[model samples]
Target: MDPAVARNLKRRVAAALHRQISDEQRATATDPDQAGLRQRGRALIEEEVARWSEDYSLAHGVPPTREQDRALAEAVYDLLFRAGRLQPYLDDPEVENIVANGCDDVWISRADEPLRRVPPIAESDDELVELLQDLARRHGGGERLLSTAHPTLALRLEGGMRLQALMAVTPRPYVAIRRHRVASATLGDMVRLGAVDATLAAFLAACIRARKNVMVTGTQGVGKTSLLRALAAEIPPHERIGTLETEYELWLHELGRLHQVVPMEAREGNGERGPDGRAAGEISIGDLIPHALRMTLNRIIVGEVRSSEVVPMLRVMTNGEGGSMCTLHARTPHMIVDRIAELCLEYGPRMTDALAYRLTANALDFVVHLTMVDETGVGGRRHRFVSHVLEVAGLGEGGRPAMNEVFAPRDGEPRGVPRTPPSCLDDLRRAGFDPRLLDSPHGSWSAPLQLQVDGRGPGRRPDPHANGREGGAR
Candidate 1:
């Protein structure tokens, strides 16, 4: 077929589809049938494809092959019902993230591959920004906008894809789409993924079942959210779980038929500051925490804690029912206490460091620290693993959080070992977990503290994972 004729046919088909969609919407305005509208739109696109393909074949003195027909249908369908130029990457199961750096330069991160460049998703920056704005309008409740006035848009699409865009805030319009790779994860599935060994998986599952307060700590893209989801699955089906997040990233409501889930997302005000210089109608995790608590929930899950919400989260974990979980960014397991203190002071109540330590010690029970290592030789991908599981022991000298190293990574091994007994021995047993697993010397691996390079030991050297491996995986 001729390229000029093909372009003309595409434009004509798109225009026809637009008109048909408008007509369908108008017809359905009084019906309140959303499924019917979608079905009509789909049928219209298909009928147009078949008619146009046949017309082109007859006029060009050639019959269209199966592949050509299929291609035409897909192209038309993308323009009609899907993200125009970015549909292919969205359909790929392995693509974990799609990053658009302006319009001409696009990149993607696959499950087992390094970040690599991809074909442009748009013809120009203006087109890219328009695409994002359209998405926000259609699927995101039309509350957020991407323009010089708002300059930022963040929302979850209908397909559960999390999108964040920056317009005038940056030199160029930037967009990022983070897809949840593991839609429905379980502890057993995570074990198969090499995220955690069978022992750790079993223990974490038991912890959840026993209604222990837990926090997953890690840097960015280290599978903290993944582990948190896997752990959340251990809660009994009869339990009512409430999840709160800045964006609805957990998708906990989709956790099958057994559990009752209440999902809440923080609403960003329309960038309107009132007389007090604060955005009016802005709702924070702090606001949602009390609301979730009043819902008679058996458990509460915060997708991630980034600010003053830590204060309310700690209060809930301590005073509210057990089994509350959240994730945060921290470099190491030991540093998480300090990290919580810093975030609380910055965003939450203006409390002294001593009060922060005391509150954490009383509220949080365990911290599961995760790390990602560049294992090109092993898997040709960055492998995220649980590096430490610390039990909060009372405040130690200088009001620092004292912790018991229950699980820590050892030399020459990817998984960490159980170094100490769990504080909740009776609870684990009641939850059907064998306490003997914690009693066994974990593979004869040396304790994490003793493995330090500067520590005195017979022939122990520094563990590379512990020594300045920051930014190892993104």
Candidate 2:
């Protein structure tokens, strides 16, 4: 087929589909009738395409090829059911993340591949903005807008993908679609993925069963949430679990093992100021914490602690029932005290550094630090693994957290030796876990830590600067 002819056909089909969609929207204006309206619109588009094809055949005295017809149909479908050019990437299960910079630039990261450029998702900046707006309106339950006034859009899509867009605030629209690949996972799955070894997996499961308060720490995009979700799966099937988040990231309610799951998401204000110049209708995680407590939750899971909410989260961890879990951003487990103290101090005036450190020490039991490491041989793809596991003993002499490094890999290896005895070994034993497992000087790894890309062993000492450690292993 001629390129000119194909382009013309595509334009015509897309135009017809767009017109049909508009007519359907208007016809169902107040009532919506989304399903019926979409059905009617698709039927109209097929009718129009059939008429156009017949007219072209009669005029040219030849039928279009199957390829041309298929192209025309796909063009119409793109305007109808799909999100224009982004539908293909969204359909791919392997795609882990999709990033769009304006309309012309698109990039995607796959589960098994590194970041790579992809075809444009929109023809122009305006089209890109419109697409994002449509996505927020359709999938986000019409709770958001992407305009100069709002200037931002954040929501979850129909396929459980999280979409965030920064528009008008930046030079061009920036959008990211984060796919939750580990929606339904278990501790065994983490072991299979090399995120943790079987020994650590068993230990984590025991901790969960023992109802230990756990916090997962890692740098951004290091799979902290993934590990948190896997740990959540370790909870017994009978216990009720509640999760609170800024966004609905932990899909624990969807897990099969858990029968009772209450999930709450924080909401951004409507960007409107009231008579007293106060933000209206804003709901924070702190606000939700008190409400979640009323539900008689067996455990509370805060998605990520980044603000004043740490105050309530800490109170719940210490004063409330055990088995609470949350994730926070920290480079290593040892830095958790300072990070929590900083967040509390930065977000609230009443919170003092002394109080923050005291609360963290009394409340949190364990911290698992996740990091991304390059694989040695097979392929050098960056893999996220559990690098360190530290037990929060108590406040030290200087008010810093006294951590027992239960697991620390030398040279970025996935496996590590157990440095300190678990504080909750008795609890773990009562929960039907083998207490002898904690006695092992070497961790559950059958072999030694050998995946270090630098060819370094556990005998190699870590860089002093990597973590803010003063003297040898406090």
Candidate 3:
């Protein structure tokens, strides 16, 4: 069926359904349940589609096929209750990113596959804007707005996908959706996916168990959030945790594995300024961090330390509980100290480079950096791996924090291998990390990673030592 025809039919049916529901609600004097509303909408969709099919048969001497009718109804239903034209892509488990430049230009990025263009989700730029506005009103507590005055929208969708949309500030309205493929992953799952070897996984799990404040750092789309989820999974189930984010990406509260999880998301304000010269009604991660501390959380996790949030987040790690964790954006492990200092400087006039470095040295125990190699342009796959893990020792020369490269990339290998023993090796041992596992320079990987460009299939080999056995001092 033609996309235009399907879109027209969807619009017509959606309008009719809206009217029908409104009239019913006015007659009943009460709102219908979601299931009841859906039932009525589906029935109306079938009736309208069947009538359209009959009229088209008489007009063109060929009726729309049964499959086309079914497709039309589903599309109408999606427009009414779901993500509309974008729902199919969101349903695809392998899809990692969705980018829309205006109404007709759409691109999709799937796991291990090259980027590809897809059909338009909206009929025009105006329609696309309307779709986004509707979505913002539906999700994220309906407080977000997208308009000429607002110009931008950022929120987490129903399936934990992060969405950012822009209008008025760009040549055309643009939107990007980032999907989390491994939202509920564990350290073992990371090993199976070849993100980390068995030895490195064991070491990271021990770090979590030993109540070390750690940070995961990497560039965009490098699996930093996924690795953070895996690390948080290492915490005992009974402990209470508080997660703070601009949007609900970590979704620890929904995991059901933790006994108690307090998930807090920051809110953007209305387009007016307050008496303090800040946006009216706006709430920031920095505001939420201290409030979370007062909640008596066993551990606090910030989804990402982007800017001013670094000040309070670092203080939490330094003075709060022992097992706090967060993610940061940095190019390399060695740059993490400088990055934190830079963020602190950006926060206000009070913070200095010396104070930032001092706070970092006392706050953080480990820095795990991830790296990604994208070869999809050459008919190869994208590989993301842990490349470095730096252990913070103390304040070093030149007002910077000193770091020991406990795990660094070996020659010709993207994954990290055990290098210098961590200064806190004894603490890791007490938390059940096997010191002998670090003896193997290969880090327990049975074979080197294979790539499609090397004329070999990118098949992951199982870790030889990935049995049920726990690694520790025993």
Candidate 4:
């Protein structure tokens, strides 16, 4: 009823409301009493607004009870700091990705199968933009709409998080956040999610520790990054690691390195960073690969080797100066090597067939093929997320690339685990694993019923119990 009292009420409600909004945006908890205060304060503002509207209507000789002007002012202030800005699941440790299809739809995926659609917390498009901008700033640099240029731009947040946002014309804007803290994921964590079992886990550890060059191939979001992160965790603590990525995605920096993770980011052009903060001059990742040679690093990691970077990466692998590891987007490990060969013709014209084969066999000591399989072979699979870890044996007579069925659960059933290829086991043995060592409790190659028969068709499953034939723990 009183104008002065209404003014005080508006100011108090706005301040408390703004603070509550800030807490929510930062993923922090707010006080319950604060909410109650906001409600009571708003009621006081509404009464004042009504008086203001009535007086104006009388002055204008119009009958009016609604305070449209005061209502507008209060609405602006209240909406500015709403709880719509907060996204708790984005910061959740279990959530791997946050996908949004415009302001109306949002979804999240965990390592385990379960894609859940979320309810819209934003009341309007402007509210959505406010929240997204705040998120961007907290992660690092915030996002904005460019009227002169493209209205959309994706970015990598500090500590290698991923963020994408789009400006809107009518409907709400779209935003998706992918937060991966490049930390070395533990094998136990992978096992818990069924990404890889114990036997394959041990084999992968040995492969990395032995300085074997490995190519991990998989489709996008098929846990390719997860598998890569898990393997990066396996890199020996004593060695130096150099990693190059389009955008820094690997967390190898925290691990051992004569130890350096040289992360190469993509510029506006199809090249890498320059000495300057801007992307004028393009520094190729292929060129950066050679720098690892001068660093005396034991292991070189390329976050994901694309076209031209592949050959140079392999060259370093074959030169005997370093072990190469990178993730590539592909359905199978066989396709990974093939793609590299095609890339070689593009990057390494001097490479011959024989030389390429020798170099490939020499450079790539192993290929860990990772693929996601649905739970139901036919349909109706709900919790249908499982990663199949396959290993590469070597070049077959096919002259293309050959893969050994190293790790796949039979009928997709969780059996004992999959056994390591005898080749890997033999290599481990020659490095001094006694034949009897496997029978000993803690032996690296020791595991029972882990290798299940494929029985899908005609195939030979290596007998880890027999002598090291294609058959031995020999």
Candidate 5:
């Protein structure tokens, strides 16, 4: 027998025995050798019984008893399936992200906090690819593995989960699975987790409701899109929301319209790229801008602005609705402004950096940023919304939006610059925003953000899904 398998059995039996027998009582038992033998033997018996149940189910059509069913599940789990290389952590809900540095090690994040190694999920490059494909197929409908010919692929899973895989021409193949689950959420959840205060969260909710063109920026695995969606979830029921992305993401209230538009980048050899000479006959996000307008959307939400789509997105949001939200990739808040400005110039090369900044500054009303601690950081760090809310006060002379260090929850309390003039707030006021909302605490403010709040879906509402609400997310 493989030593690993035998040792795993020993460890599992010992653990089960410990749970079944009290330490003090076990110490008092006579014939210690026989007692120890019996404990492990009984554990093995139970373990085998569970394993047999699973095997029986696989062989026959019958379901096992609830006890037998659970044991069978554990036995199957202990069988060392291909996904097992990562071990117990893979099954742990607290872990939010898993990263493969190479073949021998895997890392994960807990509670917007730190990355810690549990175990590797594969033995070699090939095994890792297999697990990657399996995960992709499970989360996404399916996936394609490629070499230099295909290069890279990114798709949003069926539930708006994001997955990206890249194949190399030189180095080894690399795969990353970014989990979208957040352990702590809700206004109260945020306050308890030290992410944002009720006040700041309420302010953010207000920002979303008013239809501010907001962008969330964060490093990889920092929960940028999650924060954006948390805010977007507040969009009133009456609005028609059309979301464009490479995957299906950006959910809204059940009563509102949710249209998922997947924009696939044209590939080479497939002869997809056109005159642009980039994105392989690319249907640039610029290509998708006109499509959103065609939808007559009340608001547009882009997953993340990683490319020149930044320019077209800005143009669309500025021209379309006064209230929209998007996410951007950046290490910091200021970097987000610069990235957006740089991307805009891709579409309008004649536009100066100053003009680009002004466009982003004016086009965006606020900023929210998240950061995940590097694994090397002391005491192992985690990802958190470090810069929760930033008020974009237009472009400074240097072509960066003057970031107003507004009230961010410090130790769950509002910190940073105090209230500034309400140019953005004034727009909401003009739109008939509730006047009494500003004075409420973080969790209680219920101001509505919509050009006009709708309490129903788009003519045809899908029936409420069973087991629909996961955690607290609606």
Candidate 6:
């Protein structure tokens, strides 16, 4: 089908369906449920498409084919209730990220593949902006605005994807969509994916069972969020848990194993300012943490600690139940402490460097750092694995936190190996961890990770035995 014709038909059918739904709601005096609404929408789409086919046949003496009609109706439905052209990409299990710089410039990053350009999502720049506006209005509960006055948009999509868009301040509207590939993963699942070995997986599960405060640190595009989700899966199902985030990402509430989950997302405010000189209705993650504490949660899991939220998050780890967890952005395990201190000094005006270090050392029990090896430029697949697990002991020299290297990459290997026993090994043992696993310096990996770097040149074929697991979650 021609792109132009498809776009026109989709727009027409979507508009008609919207009007029909509105009329039905007014007549019934009650809105339908989501399943009922979709059923009605699809029925309306079929009727409209049949009518259009009849009219076209009368005008041109040839009706559209059945396949074309079916395709057209599905497209129209997507435009009305889904992500339009982007819905198919989102539905693809292998697609990891989507980037759109304009209507015609789009890029897709998939598992084990180099970045590739894709077809346009919209017919024009204005249409792309309109599409984003429609998405914001539909998914953001009518509270998000995307116009010249408020040109930035951030929200979670239907299946836990995080989307960020920019307009009016850049050359063109830009969008980045990141998918949570392993939203429901557990430690056993992580082991199957080669993200962690069996021994490490058992250790991590024990850490959660022992009620330790853990912080996952990694750079962007690594698997910090996924690891956090897997760690959360170790918590007892009967325990009540609260999750706070700037946007909904971890999605711990969706896991069936967790019985009691309180999920909270921070809200952006209207453009107007209040008497306090802040956005009128803005709600920060920091604001939600204290409120979560008052809810009698057994544990609090923060999505990410990037700003002043670190202040409250550390406090939660200290004052709340001991199993509190969160993620942070850091290049290496050694940099985790410095990163937390920097965020505290920058976002918390009253916080000094010494105070930040003290709080972090006192509140955090362990730091799990993930590493990504992107060899796509050299004809190799991207590999992500846990490379380091640092145990925060206490305040050391120069008022910095002392750390014990529980697990570390050894001899240029990208995967972590057990190095030192944690100071609280007794607690882990009580939680069912085997101390003998730490006796093996190589951990539990069955084989070394095969890579393209063993004397292989750029564009050389990857070894067949190389690990081909899919990349990690957002």
Clash pairs, model 1 backbone: 308-347, 308-348
**In angstroms, what RMSD does candidate 1 have relative to the true structure?**
6.1
- For model 6, the stretches where C-alpha displacement exceeds 4 angstroms are 2-29, 140-142, 454-474
Higher TM-score: candidate 2 or 3?
3
Give the per-residue lDDT digits (tens) of candidate 1, residues 143-259: 766789889888886566788899887999888888878777788888777777667887888888888999999987788787888898888889999999888777779768336
- CA lDDT of each prediction against the hidden true structure: 0.76, 0.77, 0.87, 0.56, 0.56, 0.86
Model 2, residue pairs in steric clash:
none
State which candidate, 2 or 6, has the greater TM-score: 6
The local lDDT score (0 to 100) that residue 85 gets in candidate 3 is 90
Cα misplacement distance, residue 307 of candidate 1 (Å)? 1.2
RMSD to native for every prediction?
6.1, 6.3, 4.8, 11.0, 17.0, 4.2
Per-residue C-alpha lDDT of model 3 across residues 1-474, encoded as one tens digit per residue:
555665576677668877887898799978777788778778877887788889989999998888988888888777766788999999998999999999899999999887799998898898889888878877754479999999999988879999999999998999999998998989998998888999999999999999999999999999999999999999999999999989998888998889899999999898898788888889999989889988989999999999989989888988976989999999977678889999999888988999988999999999999988888987777888898999999988886888898888764456898999999999999999999999977687666565545433455433424643333320
Please provide, for model 6 over 336-382, each residue's C-alpha lDDT reduced to its tens digit, 9 standing for 90 to 100. Answer: 88899988886656899999999999999999999998888878788
TM-score of each: 0.83, 0.84, 0.90, 0.60, 0.64, 0.92
Give the higher-lDDT candidate: 4 or 6.
Answer: 6
Cα error of candidate 5 at position 92, Å: 2.8
- The most accurate candidate by TM-score is 6
Tens-place lDDT digits, model 4, residues 131-197: 5654433332222222213445456654456667777442457766676633556666666555554
Error of 4 at 324 (Å): 2.6
lDDT: worst 10-residue window of model 6:
465-474
Q: Name the better of 4 and 5 by TM-score.
A: 5
Deviation (Å) of 59 in candidate 3:
3.8
lDDT of 5 by residue, 323-345 (tens): 77777778765577667766777
In terms of lDDT, the best-performing candidate is 3
